[model samples]
Target: MSDTLIEAGKRTIELEAQAVKALGERIDGEFAKACEMILNCQHRVIVTGMGKSGHIGGKIAATLASTGTPAFFVHPGEASHGDLGMITQDDVVIAISNSGSSAEVITLLPLLKRMGNPLISMTGQNQSPLAKAAHAHLDISIEQEACPLNLAPTCSTTATLAMGDALAVALLEARGFTAKDFAFSHPGGALGRKLLLKVEDIMHSGNELPRVEKTALISEALMEMTAKGFGMTTVMDGQELLGVFTDGDLRRSLDQGIDFNTATMIDVMTAKPLTISQNRLAAEALGLMDAKKITALVVEDDQQQPVGLLHMHDLLKAGLV
Candidate 1:
């Protein structure tokens, strides 16, 4: 029985994968025309569908919106009552249906035509009413369903999803959307945090930064480091960064039997320590620290003067790590 279930799962995956793969070949003049219509649309793209197709339409709308294309989803059933007002003559509508003849969707055709809005249809039946009425038709037909009974909307939904992804990605490339643009739409996600967060946003500023002059005694630097709780201190001369004294440096100095009261910070500090710019992304700082095998880095300005300090704990707290 276990072997039978495994085979059934494998067969379903194979069928769905093939269905999605076939979508690439279906892209031709019709797909191009659909993209052209959307790119030239002056208003938002309104996606409408019923049942399972509605779920897929919602996801496609979200993908388009996040990838630099302004879009939203409207249910076909709701459109008949009052939601149709959401769509204007300037907007473009994308209708999804497996049979291309959903009753609720077909009922809205006359009103949509009166409004003079262009229609883009995605359906399994190219000759169906919805496709026939559309300005452009994107065929999402599949050979068979992944379900053993062939009644579920498995393979067809997979093909439709793939087609939607292809359209979104094509539009994304044409619009020259960048990671920074995507971050603006998804500020709460991990990628957004990595792209939009900077060292200055989370770095230790003001009195939180431990600092001591090169002429200061090693004991004095250690006291400052302990007070700051950062396990390190920046050794500087006025506004210029000289080096850094860390816990590791103290351990090595202790092995040398040097008196903490007599030793200067310069004698125990590591010269030319790794530094990052305040404007740089915290993700980039994480990479630099990981590569250097260090826990902290000095944040500098354009002139290489230290302004703040960033620790690995900051990245963890920001959820960038």
Candidate 2:
């Protein structure tokens, strides 16, 4: 790399670090008050800002919405042109502006106040007009911009984004939010697949389950495993699981010169095989199978009755592995 590029990168890291470190000293009673106001709001959070601050506000709104807080972003420029109709008296507005004087955001203050909507300002300058008009002000001041020209909003925007994350996390904890709750908001993501997908959701049920009676001949069990295409079969005595017979067992039985027609499933099966609960996460079943070096498992219900069967192939197909 060229010396100029190396120096620029170093400067950028140093400036951004300083900005984030400075935020620690800025968090105080005002930060607490901002969180309290949003937590008590009866309506959704409406985030607004201009330019780079607006971009950061959009991300903040998404984070808040995904983490148990209902929030949306309204462009300040649009809010002035009838978009403000989206705001209501029950809503809390979080306005973002590094200088605390973005013209677009400032212009909405009067109408917001008139609507009796609570205002929370995230700004670099506490004395600025936007901060002064807000019900609560969160100081997101940075020492310097990471930009070489010191004109572009760099470190200031980074600090503002981090502060938004802090607020979202605090609210998430206060609301007792869980992974399941987060999964509901992000159903299309990998986290949702891992947390929300159950063994029953992916397991082979009914006619697809490879099963054979304990009294059945080894040949009958092998036929059941082959027909079901799971490479294994559960040996059950009525409702009780007696054991499991797999392709490996068949190979061993063949080498031992065992008569398939005479050998019962109980005689060739491995007793007390690993089993999973139907309510368990598919990811959990994958872990168990990996730990045991097994390809398939019988899924049991709350009463320990085998309800379904799962295989490594199933997990692979579901993209869980």
Candidate 3:
């Protein structure tokens, strides 16, 4: 029975994969026209559908909105009950229906035409009323459903969703939407922290900086490291960053039989330590730390003066790691 279930799952996946592949072949002038219509839309793209198609339409609208094309989902059932008022002549409408003849959605066609709003239809039937009426018709037809009985909307819905993604990505490319722009749309997400949070925003500054004068004894650098809890300290000359002394340097000092009391930072510090600009992204700082196998780095200003100190722990606390 377990083997039978595994086979069934694999068959379902194979069928759906084939359906998506068929949809890929259908990406042509109609798909380009749909993308262009959404791109040139002066107002929001209004998406509507019925039943399972409605659920897919909602997700497609979200994808479009998040990827730089402004869009919102409007249920066809609700539109017949006055939600149609949300759409305007300036807006473009994308209607989704497997059969392409859902009554609730078709009811809005006359009103949409009167308002001179462009309609893009995603449907399984090429000759359906909705497809015939659309300014652009995306063929999301599938040979069969992934269901054993070939009765469910499985493969058809998958094709519709993939076609929706194709439209969104095409529009995304046309608009030159970037990762930074995507981060702005998802400020509360993990990607936003990785892309938007900067070293200056999370770096230790002012009194939080772990440092010692270049002329300070190794014992003083150790004290600063302990006080700052970074296991390291910058050896500075005034505001100018001269070098860094880390726990690794301390271990080497102990190994070399150097007297901690007499040894100065100049004797123990790693000179010309790597530094990052304060304006750099925290994710980039994390990358630098990982590449160098170091835990901390100095943040410098345009004048090449140390303004802050960034540690690996800062990236962890900010959720950029």
Task: Identify the leading candidate in terms of TM-score.
Answer: 2
Residue-level lDDT tens digits of model 2 in 197-250: 899999998888888898999878878978989889999999999889998998
lDDT values for all models: 0.94, 0.92, 0.93
Locate the minimum summed-lDDT window of 10 residues in model 2. Answer: 141-150
Model 3 stretches astray by more than 4 angstroms: 2-7, 187-192
Q: Per-residue error at 120 for model 1, in Å?
A: 0.2
Tens digits of per-residue lDDT for model 1, 171-252: 9999999999999999999999999999999999888889999999987997899899999999999988999999999999
Alpha carbon deviation, residue 121, candidate 1 (Å): 0.4
Error of 2 at 137 (Å): 0.9
RMSD of 1: 1.9
lDDT of 2 at 112: 90
Clash pairs, candidate 1, are none
Q: Count the backbone clashes (under 3 Å) in each candidate.
A: 0, 0, 0
Candidates sorted on lDDT, descending: 1, 3, 2
Candidate with maximal lDDT: 1
Model 2 root mean square deviation, Cα atoms: 1.8
Q: What's the lDDT of the predicted structure labeled candidate 1?
A: 0.94
